[model samples]
Target: MTASTAQDAVTAGFIVIGDEILSGRTKDTNTGFLADYLTAIGIDLSEVRVVPDETDRIVEAVNALRERYTYVFTSGGIGPTHDDITADSIAAAFGVTIDVDPRARAILEAHYPPGGLTAARLRMARIPAGADLIDNPVSKAPGFRIGNVHVMAGVPSIMQAMVDAIAPTLKTGRKMLSRHVDADIPESRLAERIGEIQAKFPETLIGSYPRTSDGRFTTQIVIRARDEDILEQATAAVQDAVSITLA
Candidate 1:
């Protein structure tokens, strides 16, 4: 899992756990950042789930995602508050014991002044047994990686720092290449041709996004593929399809 092979396609799943996000009290910005970051590193983000800060919900999402994807990243519920149950939930999902990790405690101890690491703050040091710690440069409270699951902080800054810390350690696949062609035509008019083009290039992904410009409908056809030559062929086919539709 640490090295990329020709046949390997690295994929990731993301879980956002927080009741505040579900209630719209806190906006979740980590998903988009993670998606972009993973994509840039040649890891496809296959799925994303936003679950409330409930232990069962978190466990369910973690188990489901960890089983399906090459890697699973969880953000939120790792804080020191009463509702922060991600560490315990992850332990439950993996059927492992969770306790204050000495390494994490040491890191926190160094970050916090004497007696500042209160009982509540000590919660941040808890980590599932047999897990590796992910460095959190923004904050001293470290994230943990258990199995394929990486449990990170909910805060955007801290989560971003954790991602940076873990980026170099992750395996990456062939980078996905993309090309887009904007056409001055309605999507419906090019749907059939696009379908034909898609069938011709089964290895490539073709998507059509429609929008309005000056009250006129237009479409942007985007083609993606791991192989650059295939991507170019698919994009050319899409362009031809758009031109034919216009004709």
Candidate 2:
């Protein structure tokens, strides 16, 4: 699916692929990075799914997410190792053939020394048919974008670089605006009023984050909305709620 217009809300889904992530062997940081990146670029990250290296699971998540969101991004299964089955799974998800792309091979060749492009290294050149290459400046091994899905390396630096490469081509929407109101009280004291405010401002999202400092409890109310006026109103309401509760 293509990106929606500026007036429409463009949404995205993220798929984190790797068995290590599920086994607690690797901590995932890409999800938070991508969420921030997409939000900054005006694309709402609507969903995120962490799946193992199994081809079926990858294909299932890819197909489901691709059909649901404006764009789908996948990270962690496009490497040169045998466990890197993201390319094959993406091809299967789209019912297309996948083979070594000459352009990608040329890029890898230029990066590697003479005869350095071994069979394992060549695996990085295997891209799905009708996909466009996403440049990875960190390493020469490029990522590929097929339809609305972008497959990038599992490495954080490379994935971030790939995001930069594809950022310019993406269609962005109205940026979401947010305001934070801190209350020197616990969430339990403000929960009812915050819920009432949330119901009153249906167009805005109100979230309460609670924290403890020096044996004292406090809450941070974050109000998010596309409209500045609505955000300001909701933020003011939350502040008033906090003040009234404190008084």
Candidate 3:
């Protein structure tokens, strides 16, 4: 299968591999980062899965998610350690051979100079055939594109950098925009009217987030749509329902 993104409503998924993540050693900031960034660029994140360092689990998640989404991004397990098996797992998932590619090797060699291409470092050079290279400014070790999946580092800064390098090449959709307003009224008081506004503005998404703190219930309503005009209209209706204005 090939990796494909659309000029409209591009749906994407993510695979995060690391025993550390599953064991709660590191709380994931990558998912939130990617979610906000991708949404701004018009790619909707459909799903995210965090798996262990096990190759079989990684392979399965990669294969399944890639086929179901327009694009798949994997983070973590691309280091020089023995447990960094993302590349090999991805290769196995696609039923492709895992070996150091000349292009990737050349790139690594260019970065590392004389003794830079050590065995451990060379392991980073193994990429699936016909994959594209993703620039890694943090370290010269590159991320590879196989099918529709872009595999990058687990480190937040490096992953963010890698995303910046490749995002321009993606086909993005019209960005979904939103506006929010908070009211001290209970959500139950606005439930019926909120539902009515949602029905009237079917193209827009209306969400009511309610929280109880101390002794009062507060609600925040968010209106979202690909079309700014529709989003504004929904926002107006929401304000009318709650009889509250937002500055």
Candidate 4:
């Protein structure tokens, strides 16, 4: 995905790679962040998968997603420790050789002290063949981009930095718009009406989520679409139905 060209639609998938995430030892935040970010930029976050630190699993997941989506992002398992197998796994997926690139090594060398760039720390410099580095501003240890797959750090701060760095370079489509209307009634009261409204505007996605306020029952009807006219029509219909029920 390049910055110059706009597409009719753009789609993305995310792979959260870590054993700690599956083990419940670490909570996953990257998926939610990517979902919201992609939507804001007019890209559909169509799918997501979580895989462990195992190289084979990561390779399989990466290959599948990269082929399916316009872009695939993987977060986690790219650290200096022994278990950080993401780079190796991603390289294996692309049938590339993994080696410490001089550019990456230089960055790490500059970040650490004269003698602090140990063999373990140098592991962060490994890049798959023909891949470009994704700038990591928070920590100097950079992430990398291979083909349509971007490999990022697991830490939220570092990951966010990487995302910001790459956001401007991605192609985008028309942004999806959304709005919500509140009803002073339970979801059951609006259920049938919602079905009718949805049927009327099949192009728009309508959903009802019940909410409680000050001991009163209510439902929040959310309507989303790229077409503002259709969205407005659905919103008005929903409001009228709720008002009539109250009357």
Best by TM-score: 1
The TM-score values for the models, in the order shown, are 0.97, 0.95, 0.90, 0.90
The local lDDT score (0 to 100) that residue 162 gets in candidate 3 is 99
In model 3, which runs have C-alpha deviations exceeding 4 angstroms? 1-7, 212-214, 244-247
TM-score comparison, 1 vs 2, better candidate = 1
Clashes of each: 0, 0, 1, 0
Superposition TM-score, candidate 4 onto the true structure: 0.90
Cα-lDDT of candidate 3: 0.87
Instruction: Return the clash pairs for model 2, or none.
Output: none
lDDT by residue (108-129, candidate 1, tens digit) is 9999999999999999999999
C-alpha RMSD for every candidate: 2.7, 2.8, 4.0, 3.6
- The 10 consecutive residues of candidate 2 with the worst lDDT sum are 1-10
Off by over 4 Å in 2: 1-7
Pick the winner on lDDT between candidates 1 and 2: 2
The lDDT of each candidate is 0.91, 0.93, 0.87, 0.90
What is the lDDT, from 0 to 100, of the residue 6 in candidate 2? 32
Stretches of candidate 1 exceeding 4 Å from the true structure: 1-6
